[model samples]
Target: MSFEYYYITVVSLVIFIVALVIAIIMNSRYYKVIREYLVQARGAEAKGQAMSGEVEVLACPRCGYSTTIPFRVGDYVGKVVGETCPKDGERLVVVAIYSLRPTEYQGS
Candidate 1:
């Protein structure tokens, strides 16, 4: 084989190998993201079941009053919520967040 032909063949093989590696790396990342989405979706479905949901604990820093409510998407600890304290009339702040299962919640 001519030296020119051999060198071109080697270079083309190297380029193909590099492209294959890059594609594999990108596909692995895509699959990772999909796996994470599926896990989150399953968690959301569990939380949507009867008496199972996430809750946020809110407190009034001024009067030390506290209450629990259903969790909202954007809620975070130390966030000031729009609801006023029933006892103190002050804005409530989120103090904690947690999930409740069917056996844990006792609704009246």
Candidate 2:
């Protein structure tokens, strides 16, 4: 082969190798990020499961409207008193009254 042809072939091979290396590095980084996110999600799910065991169901004292809200072990959920009820248009005070067993966590 001519010198020009040999040089072109060598340059093409070098470019191909460089491109392959770059693609591999980028894919590895992408995989790493995906793995990290999955790990974090699993950890969050476990924590949520532990927390779901302790829930508080609150009811409006004036109107008897009720809702279940999540409560952590050391945290307190504040009550909103004298708030207007969406259903009955009456002023109500919310009071924490009960707890339920754990449920599955639905990630948002």
- TM-score of each candidate? 0.47, 0.48
Question: lDDT of candidate 1 vs native?
Answer: 0.86
Please, what are the lDDT tens digits per residue for candidate 2 over residues 1-108? Answer: 899999999999999999999999999999999999998898577557545465555466556886454553543445554446667766544355334452334452
- lDDT assessment of candidate 2: 0.64
Q: Please provide, for model 1 over 1-108, each residue's C-alpha lDDT reduced to its tens digit, 9 standing for 90 to 100.
A: 999999999999999999999999999999999999998787566446523577888899999998777788998999999989978799999999887764556673
Q: Could you tell me the lDDT of residue 39 within candidate 2?
A: 82
- Report backbone clashes per prediction: 0, 0
